[model samples]
Target: MSVSDHAMPIGFLTCPGTHPGSPVRRDDAYEHDLQVDALRPALAALGHELVEIDWRSPVEAFADMPLVLVGTPWDYQDAERAFLDQLDTLEAAGHIVCNSSAVVRWNASKTYLRDLERRGVATIPTDWAQAPDISDILFAMEKFGNDTVVAKRQVGAGAEGQSIHHRAKLDPLWCMEQPAMLQPFLPQIQSDGEYSFLFVEAEFSHALRKRAAPGDYRVQSIYGGMEEPFEPSSADRAAAQAVIDAVPFDAPLYARIDMVRGSDGGLLVMEAELIEPFLYPTQGPRLGVMLATAIDRRLCQ
Candidate 1:
């Protein structure tokens, strides 16, 4: 197909269709599909087709599409080997995959925290151990010397596998047997809130400041957090840019940098979501348009 024709047929790979946070089997995902339906027309208006595919589809089917945007491959993280093998096969067969598979693999594990730490990005003090030992937990408690800390699965998403516990309340036996991350809970997560920087291609698309409504620490909207449009300050913009530039893999078609303030009032990295992050289109009016344009460019390439 010609470049123009190719631009008209961009494929949007999302999860099997359904409502987000609904009770559904992981193997038969539908929530992501439902979201893509809403996002489809926005991309379609820009002159591109949005093709939805299930994880069960053969990778070869997408080889001819100009771009395969990974909209909501939530299941891909858990089954990395299968997911990555498909991506590899597709790329080798000359297909373009947005939010590059390499980046997906790296970010899926959440262990990327260590990689970023090595790069000098300020992050919460963290320790990870598999099936943690009670003694190890005790040691970590003493090591960090924080009264309260967060215990969560290594690959947790959307507050899944997350729990807050005081040192006295924690069970050392539970720590010894689960793959988890232990880190001091930031009181600032309740104070100043978190900043999520959204980017489309290399441009700073928009940003939002998220804060839990009251008596909560999770800033996810699903957890009743409130998000307000934020105009990143010059310093904030620079900080966001630094992170974008630091991405070791290809620039993702989309990314959201989640950061928070520390006790000392300095910014600390919370999470770098290159996968399917909730882009608040209502808050950031022009972002959808900007993102559509970028997708068009990728499709035509």
Candidate 2:
């Protein structure tokens, strides 16, 4: 009924029970969405109140808020449909949302990478296959021309629903019952590290490179992944801009363009995280300020 029930500054939408801290190492890297801590002070300094809104919370709870920032809805992968429904609720209520709900819906799945490629965005070679009757799914390995292939659910985050196989039949029991993406395992991940370029509305905020712990291919904190600040080369920056140009939407309020070295000895888009990504603003407070400024500008709109 009010723009903000009590003049709430901003809503940091996240999943229920997700807190600020590093992820716990499991089979896959669990949620390490602790950037809120870094963001709180910056948002507060900007005369904005930072409130955590669980994605599962009733829309009415944050209904009156002026702007809602989709910062850490990491668990949305587990209940992607429900998450989209919540977005619908916000839009129906007419709340200004960052990374527009339309964009989130489009990016809810990794298939967007293919869409990017269709528009001239360089991306990792991905082979998609439905798991139904996939008796010898390992054929995907041959298609990618790699003895080792990485397999994952089309809509997953961090490293969940991912597996590495060495030409083994996609055992119906071993894989999730859903469409999956298969790509040649890039060995450069261990050496050069996976690259992430962070941006706030077309402006480069910062970049970080992630290296998996020994014996792991997944570069997420829970997988023992290490993070270090990185400076993008002119070529690397251009590659990131190309993906931004190919975004299905006009632009994302905040973007994390992930890339890995391809088998051809060049960088390829690993993902263009739009919905809910770990921005690692905690690496520096300025990153938080950059995000805060972006959110403030959107709210003013």
Candidate 3:
């Protein structure tokens, strides 16, 4: 397919809090700029224009866009239902929502891991609970036979509302305020770090390893975590691909498969970030070109 002669505009959806000019913008909002810088020129090279728009903007504002990429709406977790509704509305109006609303919904909750596990994708052992209390945590610890456990909200991002508790330090009053997933804490996180495999249109793009700060276990940049380009062994790459294949849906426009090495020396799916995952353009320099090419192909189709 040939590139269009005219520069068609593509929508890159962000939230008000992540917009550059927002008074309440997040400190990590610079990630939005980095991604834009990476993709804007590449899209322009393909005779396409990238428009940064707040996702909460009126529906009419997106009428002219042929495709909308679910970009950095980091605040979407706070209003997940509304976010999903907006995507459904845009898709219904004939704008191609990359990853699509269905994909977003399937991925909105961490429980999707269960689906993948059912499809034979290896995942960390997790106990799902509704607003787990101290008793539940203890049950998870006993079930996994591990003294340390990590508890995270079923619907959250960037390590928000996450906690780590050791058997010795267990707080009797501690309890999750929302539906949560409890898993034994793998000490490998501090040693080997977590690996991220990026895919565009289900094709591999690049890989990176994210390590937490000295005293933190969260690998998100907001927690002072750092990442570097990584060359994955073919076996490890295949492990990540298995996750994509198990997605139970058509290929999304982009995906970030985050994994960690399990005790048995195999990678376990940590999270399959299909919605608004930071692509780590710095680690994957060709990300823009690959994504632009894929988007152009989709547009041509």
Candidate 4:
């Protein structure tokens, strides 16, 4: 393929840890490379150059790029305000940001699940707390009538600060130190596994089932989880689609609807990952082309 003289540059916002050759790069940083490798070639074919730029870089560094994808800034949760400010700055400069700042702000907090619930999307039962202590955990457990429960940060990703507690193993002094969400621990996460439905430009691209390692509840790759391609039934697909339909904004450039089966045998929204969810391109080989095509359409518009 011949390189175009006027290939447009598209920025992919990554974190220092996911940047190539960073000393503090994460163990799972390979996922960043995999995502870039999948999209780069396809973008090149469309005369768009995919440039990996660290999200923390000076705002001026992004001036040349007219479009930016909120790629893998996996540590954003640790410095969420700064990360969001950067995206807002980019948008103010007239740059197109995939899953725009508005979407980012809405999805930054897990509380967005409440919005989905109000909009008629089925979500796991959760209790919101400013900072949950043992009492809060006990209350949530009692409300859900489950002996085991999961506690997670309201603003978090990759299950970084997540913990599971059981009545038998409860600790009196333990608490989630930040704003938290408490939910009954679903056995389905271990038995049937979690499902991820990948969408590009609001269209279903692929689906996968993610299973955690033995004795673990998190299905993230860093937690020793594995994924297998899944062909969802029509009902399952519609369930996932309902989440997309409920999103208040126009369809984002990309969305990952993570779900788990409930005790009632229906899927519940785990998260509607709009910010920087790993698209699992390996399982969805068409992801690169699908995204590139979507980007091209956006550019044309």
TM-score of each: 0.85, 0.86, 0.97, 0.95
Give candidate 3's whole-model lDDT: 0.92
Worst 10 residues of 3 by lDDT: 1-10
Candidate 1: tens digits of C-alpha lDDT, residues 1-301? 1234444555565543333454563533444544465456667777577776655478767765767777666666567688777777767777777777788778877788788777777788888878665565666677788778777778768888787777777675554345788788888989889999888876887888999979889997678998877888888787777777677776788888899888887778888888677666556666766777777777556
- State the TM-score for model 4: 0.95
Top of the candidates by TM-score: 3
Please report the TM-score between candidate 1 and the true structure. Answer: 0.85
lDDT of 2 by residue, 1-301 (tens): 1232233468888654464333532332233345767677777776778887767778779856778888776677777788888887887798877778899988878888889999998888788877623333467666767778777888777678788776554455565588888777888998789999888787777788999999888888877889988888888888888888789776788898999876666679999988877777755456777877767666666
* Model 4 spans with C-alpha error above 4 angstroms: 1-6
lDDT of 4 by residue, 222-245 (tens): 789999879999999999999998
Q: Determine which window of 10 residues in candidate 4 has minimal summed lDDT.
A: 1-10
The predicted structure with the larger TM-score, 3 or 4, is 3
Runs in model 3 deviating more than 4 A are none
lDDT of each: 0.73, 0.76, 0.92, 0.92
Backbone clash total for model 1 is: 10
